[model samples]
Target: MWEVMSDPQSSLALPVTRLTRRKTLDQVTAECQSHDLKRTLTATQLTLLGVGATIGAGIYVMTGEAAADYAGPAVLVSFVIAALACLFTAFSYGELSSTLPVAGSAYSYAYVSIGEGAAWTVGWLLLLEYGISCAAVASGLSGYATSLLSDLGVHVPAALSQSTFQTVLSGANLTLTVGPRLDFVGGLAVMIVTALLVRGVQESARVNAVIVVIKVGVLFVFVGFGLQAMHAAYWHPFIPQSEGGFRYGLPGVFRAASIIFFAYVGFEAVSTAAAEARNPRRDVPIGIVLSLVICTAVYILVASVLIGIVPYRELGVADPLAIAVNAMHEPWLALLIKVGATVGLCSVLLGLLYGQTRIFFSMSRDGLIPAAFSRVHPTLRTPWIGTILLGILVAIATATMPLEVISDLVSIGTACAFGIVNFTVIWQRNTRPGITRPFSVPLGGITIGGFWIGIAPALGIAFCVIMTLPLCIDLLRALGNGNPLPAILLGIYIVIGIATYFAYGRSHSRMAQAPFDAD
Candidate 1:
């Protein structure tokens, strides 16, 4: 059904087109069956894919930074809050993926439940989420790689190992300034992962699974040794007294959750694999929820041990885990930690890069973007052109952007995307009550004002709003204080999405031209 522009003279008027057009469930499922992508992924592989993507940067890289800067030892509380929020959304994802079973993840769900315009918006945000996340993970990987190389008597120059730009504080104002250093290691890492992804999903998944095991084991070793070195005094003031604004206190804990929420970004990547799963209805849901459950448990355990071993203030470095291991006075374990972090973050890059390409592939297939993105390699069945294009852009970002800057942006983008994912469940439950749902959100819902809202999805939406509030508050506070770069970047991205839709997507959308596949 087309939505006609009611006010033709309005500044924001769209052409009389199907901006709110949605795809039928049948149509989505039919495309899933007929897509050119190979369907070789099993339940176990999909779960590992989620684990591979999720377990790396959060535990190995970001935990220490979050502890030192935001929550101190209470970062464990931050993890619990973030995990609870994500669990609600994860349930929503399981429901939608089982019902629709398509590529594009939240973007695809939005297309089916909400409209094309919303889908475009979600897809664009996903680009921010997955693409920025790749750069963030790569940055963390570079830090660990540099530490490992230095241990092996190989020193990488600061120029090649560090970011090209740094965030500077001048009397209260935070601004990003360019530097001569160029994170060559991080950029090169992205290109290597991109090449592996282009080889095919099965090959990538196999590699990711092996690395997942290695990293998990390495983390376990850290916990074993870390406990021996635990300083009970480190947990004395678990909730540090407030220094000023959100630096160390209860407020800081929530703020920490907002930042570390980036840790859970990989859980949704499983939904993006719907088109590639051998039994999407059965396997995708299992993958989405199971991966999150396992990862959350691991996050809490590792974080508990990490903070117990080191003073929170000392964890602000890029290689926080390495710092913890070094304090253990075990050079061998420290070396092992660095190696595991390097191998582990590579899988994160692979999973996120894969997700970004698949989202573009789905959008392109719908004629909402360029057709080249949808074009698959004849033999490999991967979106080669799109993969390469996104990879180069991610590499450039990794080379230029700092970890702290990009990680916050990724969390914000990911939270917004997840909110929409939760809402899709509520919208579809009401609008298409008869649709077949192979898996449903565990908790039942209630009817209000004649609209049915699932318990899990409603909570998911609320948690997302809660998760986003602090990050946005922090962003605005920074702007008011002096830092405007992150806010400006987010504004520019939203504007670009709006412009791109009117200039190309609206006209090119298949829904605008094809007969309405009405319910």
Candidate 2:
């Protein structure tokens, strides 16, 4: 006999269990074993994937500007702070990915520990995180690519090379101004990566690994060459006094940390590759932790050398690293850095696009979205349709939008998803104590009110929340002063997400067909 429960909130007699349904660990593991994504990714490839994603525009482009505008020499401290926050979240991810070994990353973990609704919410946030982030990276890539071309005597018209819109803040009001330009270069870049992704995961990983080597080598060359020109006097005002708000001071360091938190966002890309990892249990955790550790080291070393070689105030340009390389009196090195950045961003695009497609693949398998997203190509064994569709949407957005204005929104979305991952660890510990965890978060916790909250996850949640504060405060300040565009856009996205869930997902969810399994 099947046991049933009532849904007091619904008139359609939908079972109450469907509203708060949790997928069993056994089910998730079984699905991973049977998934269509080819298990071709090795530990090295996965680590490089994480590196490829994490090391792009953030270090090459944002670092110098962050130091100049917000943190000064203290941006090194800012990187450490952001890395610590991601470290906690990465630890939580390591444990869960090893346990579940599923495609959706945080969304899949949420489905197993929390309810389906929360899983959908996490998936929605991930869409915002990875999708918009890909567009933003492509937009940044356009700048480097266009510059590199001009250096070679090849010129692209500004109308075909620039974004169609710009976000401006005048006094208190925020306005979006249209322009007669289109980012064809960025759009073409997105399509090229999309084509590579559709070919197969292994092929994309190989390309990404090669690009990673080139960029990492480029950065190392800068560090090695720039060290001899170090000016210790540049380090005197380590912590610049506050110039009001988060402009320059200790507050500015935290503010800079919030912005550069985007740098650490892609470390979780390792978890998203779980379904394709050859040995997901061991490899996923290794990839997640190792990539973060390496990238953080690189960020700190590069920032230290950059500040030593050049005054922080001069780093606010689009090419901070190039400026530092020029300061080394090595124009050749500057050219190399620009070329590396241009090639390097393709790997970032590859990793992010791969993550986004796989996440939707997982969601589609769960029946939350259309089944077309999960359909695997017969020859390539890749989710071709979804990959192409998402790539097109992102490319269009990259061409049309002024992504700089909404980049922090990606940071906020990532932190929210990461917080949920940490929370899932705590929740799973309490609810499914007997389940085998191939890896576990370090720093065990005591039972608090009958719920065991691991120290790592607790701090992970706290760190994510703390990192999110400065960004949220900035958004609120903009809203209070008269700019409502960002808040309005976020609200619209949430409303559409809710409407989609209730209109289609709630009724069509796979859990709706299965009996509640308390065991």
Candidate 3:
């Protein structure tokens, strides 16, 4: 087996085959040609797809939670911090996507720049990131859907609407109980989005573009009304003093930044569509950077207005935007906000499902997993099988897991992927100096001695690492609090991933059987 093979030339403890093997750019491009997808997505549609994916349930839900629980009104600062981290990573992604122009996003970049082992790790992490994230967004969609239906005098049964785990709070004590209920609404949302994705990418993009418009328009309406109803007194102490250690102080702001960082998770999904992009090089970069900038601006404005309209303490709810709308006593606008959140979260699930399928497609093509995952629809030119399978898994997760648990796993996984991508750019710049890059990280002339420093990617790596620390602390805290199921689940996922790679992927990798070509 490849995992057991030893290098006779080296005395190192680890296997050289695992560390030294890399897929060349030529092979990746050739593989893409062999299994080509329809290129129907333009820069504009791609940007909207990104916006649709990103400006979803997180902004609607996490804003209130972050403000009420962690940063107070200073959640605005947290958004800025998270946006900065995403911005740094966006530049690195822009460069790599233009350079590789493959379907796997960071995973493809890792295969070419790093090695198969690292690529497998990244691919595994992305599965966790996109899969859990879709489930998380679906769970949020359930809340918005229930709220909207309730306003129309349609009541969903509590047993059918809620997740298996129920949280009960009595004064200072918090308790979680396992129940027989299922989040049927959330599961239904995932299935609906999966059907849209399996149809075609162009159709999905068009639907997403329309949803993006409605959602953005709704937010603008909230901002306009919220500014009118602003309470100046709420802005007095922007960063509220901490009642305890990491709650509502400077530390709380950083922690909230890590939490709300999930809002920007969908931007990188743009790169995963490179294989389907009309012009991968130009469109992917534009879609990524443009979407990040636009979403960050919108998030800042919405957070400010939301906090201004209601005290930060009162803003924590499943639907913060709706809460703010109702606080103004505008019933009509509140209804619109609820409808907008449902549409927004629908698009989020679609975008995530799209990205997840493409990642599996790319990994399967490289013989990292089952080739069945790479199977494209004869007419739709989509990874139908993977899409359906992933959708089913996400539906199951949504039906069972709590939203907060899934959200935290997504944040941690995405942060890890971003950190690896940053390092990939840095490594590629040093090793493949002669490779023609359609887009390059700017300000590379600034050097420390002989090494040309990439300020953007360097900061990207630092920020990603910084953002991940809090999530790690939160995970440890969860375990300490006797809630070890999530951590144990994540450990099991890693073990399965590692075992699969060594057992199947190592022997089946295309790069291993083919001769290494420098070009």
Candidate 4:
């Protein structure tokens, strides 16, 4: 065992051997069949799960910030653009999930179509996408919770509700300064969601479904009242001219689209639950596409109402929707909206935490991580260890860091993962022509000189790459402005992942021991 552990071949082999090693479809299917997670999720439940994941604190909070800082009344256009990008990527995800129908979402798809190294990289990115996303959403939830409590004549002390560094905006200039505080509310919210997740998947799904109904219903109410009260003059200069670069012009629209793209993060989480899905081939695709459609429509309507009823300049608060409701002088409705935002954020936290645990579970089972992470509760059948540990880490993050910092990191990570998934679909179609894809991406038969071209995946790749540019710019801007902490932290994470692969995962992978026989 020590010889195997210390083998020089094991250390050097990861670059060549692991990169060439691909998990066969048969092996993936066998693992899915043998996995301990119960198949209890139906198409309806899955759809709600996607909605529960997608429509969260982002819509409730970021819509205002995006509108005020970037797109103005054209925020609706930004939402449409982001939705279109997500739609393209969702189609590719639909095809892959239908074909693979395993846990780990893109990570599992990459393992089969790409290779071990690519799979590990995608898994590492997913940890950022789902785990940090939970932290960001939990922090957002804390703000809404505070507002709700304030309405009930209870106020949280500033020292217990805010971050150490406070960001203050003046005109187009932003400043960050030291103002130490601990976000106990955010930490508590994560802990509560984590406890609920460890109890079981089915129970969590049920709770998520209920939360989806409440939040969606509240959004409809907002639309109903907002349209009635909208003043056409507020939207006069729809795409307000930019005072400077990336501020309320076409550039701002695209930038806002990239920023608000975080709103669509949850649809991919649906695919992560494929192993627990009752009819993965049919239901997973339906869940992915249907949820995107539902959420996009809601987002467009909500953004329009928000800017129509309240000018875009005034919409840049933590609870934008509630603030819009409050402007109408309907105290009861404002309370209801506040409640919806809080519940909505809780559901998002739950879905992300669930996806994060499943990703770790799949990687661990493949021997890329510790086996203890893969252990499912005997009766509950959930990856309790990973779930608890991730929850603790997220709690600490939410309690310490500001929302914007965590959210920006999540956007970059999610975009990279989406780009990889889109490329994986194109690669799989080109290399494995005969593989059975239960749901093939539409418009793939435009043959040009004996070669087939898939339009959807191609568009998917373009859109994902386009959305990532703004995030990269934001990262650079942050670094240039002396806010290098998030970038440094993300770099450290990637380095650790690469180091772990070389030191342990490379030698221990099940595929390294016995390569999958495609036949």
Best by lDDT: 2
Query: Residue 130 in model 2: shift from native, Å?
Result: 0.5
C-alpha RMSD of candidate 3: 2.6
Q: Which is superior by lDDT, 2 or 4?
A: 2
Worst 10 residues of 3 by lDDT: 1-10
Q: Which segments of model 4 are wrong by more than 4 Å?
A: 1-14, 163-180, 445-451, 481-483, 516-519
- For each candidate, what TM-score against the reference? 0.95, 0.96, 0.94, 0.92
The top-ranked prediction according to TM-score is: 2
Global local distance difference test of model 2: 0.90
Which residue ranges in model 1 land beyond 4 Å of their true spot? 1-17, 517-519
Arrange candidates, best lDDT first.
2, 1, 3, 4
For candidate 3, give the lDDT of residue 116: 80
lDDT of every model, 2 decimals: 0.87, 0.90, 0.86, 0.85
Better of 1 and 2 by lDDT: 2
Candidate 1's displacement at residue 121, Å, is: 0.9
What is the model-wide C-alpha lDDT for candidate 4?
Answer: 0.85
Q: Which residue pairs clash in candidate 4? A: none
lDDT of 3 by residue, 1-519 (tens): 333345554456345555457888788778767775899999999899889889987789888999999998889889989998999899999999988888999998998988887888899899877887888888889988997899999999978888998666555334568988999999999998889998999999999999999999999988988899999898768899988756889989999999889889999899999999989999999999999999999999999999888888887777777778888999999999999899899989888888989999999998888888889899998888888888999999898877565577778889999999988988888778888889887657355666666888888888998798888887787778777766876788789988898889987987776764322
Give the 10-residue window scoring lowest on summed lDDT in candidate 2.
1-10
lDDT of 2 by residue, 1-519 (tens): 124444345545343456568787778878987877789999999999999999998898789888999999999999999999999999999999988999999999988887887899999999988998999999999999999999999999999888899788898877888989999999999999999999999999999999999999998988899889999999979999889999989989998998899988888889999999999999999999999999999999988999999899999988888888877888888799998999989999998999999999999999999998999998899999999999999999999999887878888988899999999999888987888788899999989789898999999999899889998999899889888888887888889999999999988888777754433
Tell me how far candidate 4 lies from the true structure as C-alpha RMSD in angstroms: 3.2
